[model samples]
Target: MRLNQFISHHSKYSRREADRLIEEGRVNIEKNKADFNTVLEVGQRVFIDGKYLKAQNQDLYTVIVYHKPKGEIVSKKDDRDRRIVYDTLGAKYAHFISVGRLDFASEGLLLLTDSKNVARQLMQSDLEREYILKIKGSVTKEMIEAMEKGLSLQNATLGAHHKSKIKAMDFAPFLKYEVTKEGTNFSRLKVSITEGKNRELRRFFAYFKREVVDLRRVRYGWIELNALPVGKIRFLNKTEYKLLHQFLSKNDKNFYVSKKYI
Candidate 1:
């Protein structure tokens, strides 16, 4: 990994902070001052301020589930000065990396981990995400067709962030969907999809001229929100950890879990 990423993954420093440390000549790799672009190899020894930054025990890591509430950005710091997930997570979890993101207007089960590798794995995996949505207007056949057959839009920015440069997007077929409440003014439905593209659900509904009034994720892979209250966090239970261990073992040949996690 790059020096900045190595520091960020193993220490409390952010990638930007790691770069600053390198610039200040406080970081060294094998007794030589490291640059921002330095890439570390296996068994490399890193020192910061003459103190060794021990390599992580790949078998040991922690994962937490946070019922992220609406109105909070999933970032370390926001230029807009809005509330961020760390504000609620507190300093104790300041270094944890979020697996994926629940947009500012969306809420529900969010995974965070102290291991950057774990976070990257989960985020990039094609795990099913289940959501309950309350949308404007009834579910139409057109929407159902798109959900079932998949969709591709060249101007897929309707429900995306204003600063997003992603104008085109290809959507995979939804895993499943069920309409629980149908009405002209609003409708409620539960849907599952494997991809976690930017504002994907919102963009899909927007294509049908429907607005998602409320969106909440209830499940991701084997993990569920269950009865977790809004804005609270809990460590992954033993069962979840076991499942995670199985998944990691399958995906990464080098990955190992401590017996405690199994």
Candidate 2:
């Protein structure tokens, strides 16, 4: 595994924070400063600020589904001093890192995991995310068709003003969609996408000069936010954990439960 992944999986640090620690010269392997992509050997000694980081106990893992509320950042720490998801969950679960992001204004179905590999695998997997979005303008058949068919969005359309070499015609396929409400100005719709890109759903409508007024993810993978009140955090049930483990362990099928940490 990469140094960042190894550190995050074994320590309380998230992958991003692990990278930051490496960059800040706090992490060392064999008396050498570690880089984010440094490969970790089975018995390699890794020290963070002179303290050794033990290899992760593969058996001990915790994953939770959080019903995130609007106005809360997904990060554990924010400079803006705004209420973050960790604040709601409190310090007890501070070690959990969000699987993917729900922007400050968006809400619902946020996944948090203590296992760095699980977090990485889920985001890169073919799991679909279902979202219920409220927009300020009504969506027409043509607009929906364009979205379903995929748009040739320019970098500027995606707000990438600096990189002109990026292709404008990358296809972003929507798995499913439904118009929940159609009004004179506002509209509510449910859409699903297998691939999650940074702000892709919001930017999809923005390509046509329309903005998503409100966005909430109601489902992710096989997990649904059923009866979970907003801002509540719950551990994945046994069946849910099995399903997630099956999906995440497709490539590495040697998941063992450890009693070392819980």
Top model number, lDDT:
1
Question: Candidate 1 vs. truth: CA RMSD?
Answer: 2.0
Question: Which residues of candidate 1, in runs, are more than 4 Å off?
Answer: 14-16, 29-32, 36-45
Candidate 2 lDDT over residue span 175-204, tens digit each: 888999998789899999887566777667
lDDT (CA) per prediction: 0.92, 0.80
- Please give the TM-score that candidate 2 achieves against the real structure: 0.79
Candidate 1 lDDT tens digits, 1-262? 8999888778989889999999999999888988977899988999999999987776789999999999999998999999999999999999789998989999999999988879888998999999999999999999999999999999998888899898999999999999999998999999999977899999989989999889999999999999999999999999999999988889888887679866
lDDT of 2: 0.80
Worst ten-residue run, lDDT, model 2?
A: 156-165
**Quick one: how many clashes does candidate 2 have?**
2
For model 1, state the Cα shift of residue 153 in Å: 0.4
- Model 1, residue 53: distance off in Å is 1.8
